[model samples]
Target: MPDYKKNSISLTGAVGLGTGVMISAGIFALLGQVAELSGSWFPLIFIIGSIVTAFSAYSYVKMSQEYPSAGGIGMFLVKAYGKGTITASAALMMAVSMIINQSLVARTFGTYTLQLFDGAQTEWLVPLLGVGLIVVSFLINISGNTFIQTFTSIASLIKIIGLSTMAIAGIIVADFAFTIPNKASNPPDIGIVSSVAAIALTILAFKGFTTITNSGEEITKPKKNVGRAITISILVSLSVYLLLAWAVSSNLTLSEIIAAKDYALAEAARPAFGDFGVWFTVILAIIATITGIIASVFAVSRMLAMLTEMKLIPHKHFHMPGSIQKHTLVYTVVLAIVLTVSFDLTRIASIGAILYLVMDIMIHWGVFRHLRKKVNANPFIVVSAIVLDLIVLSAFLWVKFQSDIVVVVVAILMITFIFIGEYAFLRKTSD
Candidate 1:
């Protein structure tokens, strides 16, 4: 271990990092898909998703209390499952999912920004901008923790206030009639099953709370503050998501939302306050995505560094300069850039969501079945977390399987390859 400084971030810094990741571009990009499944009640779906997320958060909260480390979930998994392929694979899945998230956010930055331009439908514009952002984030990340914290705190504040203002503005201008402009091909009656299933997708909006746990070692008081940070991040994110969903649902018709699905919030703004509103929402998105990528890269790189120190996964440097953490930062950014360039936005989001929920399921189950007594965690909460994750994950997988089987297969193959590669590496190192 490199003995990095502990307690580097204050309480506000921790919360900022949490919100930086949670209130991400994912919210902007994913609203339409969730609404398609959820119909007119999409805002309520966000509320329901928060309840489901609360259950999943229980395991992480308890684990952080018992074992606070920079390693975060990686450390928790090691405690529950030991230093083996399982821990290594789970951690890598998480790291990769976050990398995918950076790409998702980066691409979102591109999509939203281009909306400000005329004839902005160029083919290569999005990935180019996405890669540019990743490079910028890498530079900012290497500058040190204070800069990262300060910038993220300020950005988080701006994004939250901007989103709130948009919501309120939309509400003030709305006529209170909630109606979908173009009726869907499916029946108008959206049942509870469909709404509950939509929780699988909506969960993505709040999943970034785990980014806070990755900074456990840096928080001023890990045991007390990590939990608080996670709780605050989710609550604030949920509030923002609901407000935006309400604003969009109330202001824009269903067809308008789906029509500008790539940039729904911005499109919704057009009807509410015209071009100025459009620019306002796009600017907020650009800021949100930039901060989101930086926060994610910061946390995931530290996590990979921790995993390397634990020797649960393979690590090598081609005579790189700076610390192991810096090398990990490079690796994280490069991989994210590749995903940004290669995959489309929807595919990247699906891959990330699947990897994340699967990893969450493993974490919850590992704790529930093995470490419940060890950590003094409530078995029921752990169990509920596992069950909720299972239901949501199953719903998500089924939906993807029906809509895009290739993504699900790709995700499964990625997981399998990570496990096999880890096992082989461990065997060789042991020998």
Candidate 2:
């Protein structure tokens, strides 16, 4: 049996756990892409992304109140449908998305780290850094949550402090680059669509509630704290994101920014703080991303643990403790291999972001569907949730359809693998 602890974390800790796990992508890197997409509408994009995500967070709280457990959205999807292949597929995706998300961060961290020094290419530096991050976090996992939780708390603090410091620094030292009123624009084209998609990409920076779910075994007050932490985490993360967007946008012209393209935060910081700014951000990125990697390693390990227990995966793989802990280390090493081999942080984060969005939407969609039919909750509320989620799904699919054919194919292949894996598991169990 799993040794469960009650309220090991305060309600505040639950919220911090979510924000801590997810906010690395949102803050340390993403300004350049967001600025490019929003054009003159960066502020609007930030607010819109926050509003939509706020609703999604609310859905999570509502669902958590109903079915709180460490299983995350996997459990939510499973219980709603009475458990089947669809549930199996959902859990598999969640498990993979968590892996993909961390890889994206690990890659980003490596890239940013190498960039700190002159004539250094973040391209190669990032991969090695990614492997190192996996190794470090894996060690943290073995000590158990007693150590892991405290370390994660520190990582969470680094993220907030770094971002806040950057925002404040930008305000004090960096120039405010606001859009001129009444800038003429044309009808939206593929260029525009891609740009909006990029801004939507900014939303990915704030997605990390699963870390809290993965830590479910450690959480003391599961029901109350899970929902509480998720909500607070998203809100705090959003606030930081909004501040970042504003800081970066304030430092460059809509046109100079769109032209300069990538890493606007670094470029913006360079002018105001000069050498101080660049070095500070580089160090900050390293610290913030290290924190993110730890959070990611923890989340994926637990998700794997849950899937193994549910019989959807081979029983031997779930590392509960002792022998099981090795599974977490193995998963960490596998992610390191993926991260070390990959150089393109944007593409990596892009694929990860899209896959995660699909899972999040599906998780919420399953909840809404269940509440509407089985629970017979308020039709009006349920309809609103469904309608809003439909908008999110449409946006997600539309963007995915336009950008990468690989993501779509990969998603299908992943689902295929899940069924095959599950089928093989059942066969072994019967024997």
Most accurate candidate by TM-score: 1
Number of clashes recorded per candidate: 0, 14
lDDT of 2 by residue, 1-431 (tens): 26335556666566656766667756555655565555666656666766666666665666566666666666677666655666766676777766776776676666666657787464556677777777776776667655666766776777678877888777665445443312443214435455456544655766687677666546766757776677677777877777766776667666565543334556667766787777777777676667677766766666666666676666454534565435745765585557446635556566656666666666666666676454334545544645554655456456767666666566667667877876676667766
* Span of ten consecutive residues with least summed lDDT in model 1: 178-187
Q: What are the candidates' C-alpha RMSDs?
A: 1.7, 3.5
Give the whole-model CA lDDT for all candidates, comma-separated. Answer: 0.86, 0.63
Model 1 residue 410 lDDT score: 96
Q: Please identify model 1 stretches exceeding 4 Å from their true place.
A: 1-3, 176-194
lDDT of 1 by residue, 1-431 (tens): 45466888887888888889878776888887677666767778888888988998888888988898887889999998999988999999999998998998999999998988976488799999999999999999999889999999999999999999988788778865554444553346455666666787678778888888888888888889889998988999998998888889887777667667778899889987999999999899999998999999999999999998878778889999888899999999999999999998778888988898889999998998899987788988888888888887787787778768999999999999999999998888888
TM-score list, all predictions: 0.96, 0.86
- For candidate 1, the C-alpha RMSD (Å) to the true structure equals 1.7
Clashes of 1: 0
lDDT value for model 1: 0.86
State the TM-score for model 2. Answer: 0.86
